[model samples]
Target: MKINKNIAISDSGFVFNPVNGESFSVNPIGAEIIDMMKTEKSYEEIHKTLISKYNADEATIEKDYFDFVGLLKQHNLIDNNEEA
Candidate 1:
């Protein structure tokens, strides 16, 4: 999925959505996920990268990833026109 073009993110995990004037702070993993998404990384690529970098199992990662993406969708952080 792609982040909204108007959203701004920082290396320190701070995210700002200019469209809504909303800001958020994410955990390190979440930051990494957002960074990867900004690059238009596919789910498989993200899954493999997370699997190699983290100790979590595939099922756990899968669940968390989807949950996070859902949250992003709910918050309108992802571009609606983009395919996940």
Candidate 2:
């Protein structure tokens, strides 16, 4: 999924969605995952990267990624074209 143009994301993982008038903070891992999603990375690609970087198992990464994606969907931060 792609990040909404109205959203602002900082290197420190501070997220601001102007359209929704919402602001949130994320940890480093969440920031990394969100940045990857914004780049339009596929699930497989993101999964692989996270697995290598975090030394996480497939199942764990998959579950976490799904949750993260779900959050993006919930906030309507992602565009329809990028919906999974």
Candidate 3:
């Protein structure tokens, strides 16, 4: 997914949404996930990358990835066209 134009995201996981006039922060894992989503990575790509780099399993990553994307949508951080 693509980060909204009104949002600013830092490498450190800080997110500021000008539209909502709010800011939020995430952990390193969340940040990396968002960054990958920004690149428009497919679900398979994200899953594969996580599988290779992290200790987590496919089922866990799959659930969390979808949930995270849902949260981004809820917050208007990403647009419909950008969804994986």
Candidate 4:
């Protein structure tokens, strides 16, 4: 999924949505995922990169990834117009 065009995410994991005037902060890993999403990376690529980079096992990483993405969806941080 793509991050909204007007959304801004800082290197320190601060997020801002200009449209709604909402702001949030995520942890380092969450920030990394957002950065990747900004680049239009596919889900598979994200999963692979995260699985390889983090010390956690595949199952845990996969689960957390899904959960995190779900949170992003629930919070309207990602664009829903396009399928991922």
Candidate 5:
């Protein structure tokens, strides 16, 4: 899936959605995920990166990744045209 093109993200984990004029903050991991999405990285690429950098196992990272994506959906932070 793709992140909304207008969203503004900061290195300090501040996220601003221009369409809705709403702001949010995320943890470091979440910020990393968003950054990857911003670059149009694929899900498998993100999963591999997270698994290598963090101590989490494959299954856990996969679950958490999808959960985070679901949150983005709930908030309309992602493009509706993309597949999840």
Candidate 6:
């Protein structure tokens, strides 16, 4: 999935949707995922990178990644037309 171009994300994990005027805060890991998504990283690449950089296993990372993406989707933070 791709982050919507209009969404504003802060380095401190603050996310703002200008369209809806909705703001949210995420953890460090969630910030990293948002950064990677903004860079157009694929899910598999994100999963691999997280595994190599952190102590988490592949399965855990994969599950968390998808769950995060799902939340983004539910909140309309992602661009459904774009491939992530």
Q: How far off is residue 42 in model 1, in Å?
A: 0.7
Candidate 5: pairs in clash: none
Order candidates by TM-score, high to low. 5, 1, 4, 6, 2, 3
* Rank order (by lDDT, best first): 5, 1, 4, 6, 2, 3
Q: Estimate each model's TM-score.
A: 0.92, 0.84, 0.81, 0.91, 0.95, 0.90
**Prediction 6 TM-score vs. true:** 0.90
lDDT for each residue of candidate 3 in 9-34, tens digit (9 for 90 to 100): 79888998888788889889888888
lDDT of 4 by residue, 1-84 (tens): 788878799989999989889999999999999999889899999999998898999999989988898888777888766564
> All models: lDDT?
0.90, 0.81, 0.80, 0.88, 0.92, 0.87
Q: Name the lDDT value of residue 3 in candidate 2.
A: 68
Once superposed on the true structure, which residue ranges of model 5 sit more than 4 Å away at CA?
none
lDDT of 5: 0.92
Cα deviation of 22, candidate 3, in Å: 2.1
Residue pairs with clashing backbones, model 6: none
Query: Alpha carbon lDDT of residue 51, candidate 5?
Result: 91
- State the displacement of the C-alpha of residue 1, model 6, in Å, after optimal TM-score superposition: 1.9
**Whose lDDT is higher: candidate 1's or candidate 3's?**
1
Worst 10 residues of 4 by lDDT: 75-84
After superposition, which runs of candidate 3 have C-alpha atoms over 4 Å from their true positions? 81-84
On lDDT, the stronger of 3 and 5 is 5
Candidate 1 structure quality by residue, lDDT tens digits, 1-84: 788877788989999999999999999999999989888789999999999999999999999999999889889999767666
Q: In terms of TM-score, which candidate is strongest?
A: 5
Off by over 4 Å in 1: 81-83
lDDT per residue (tens digit) for residues 1-84 in model 6: 679878888999999999999999999999999998889888879888899999988888888888888889889898766554
Candidate 5 TM-score versus the reference: 0.95
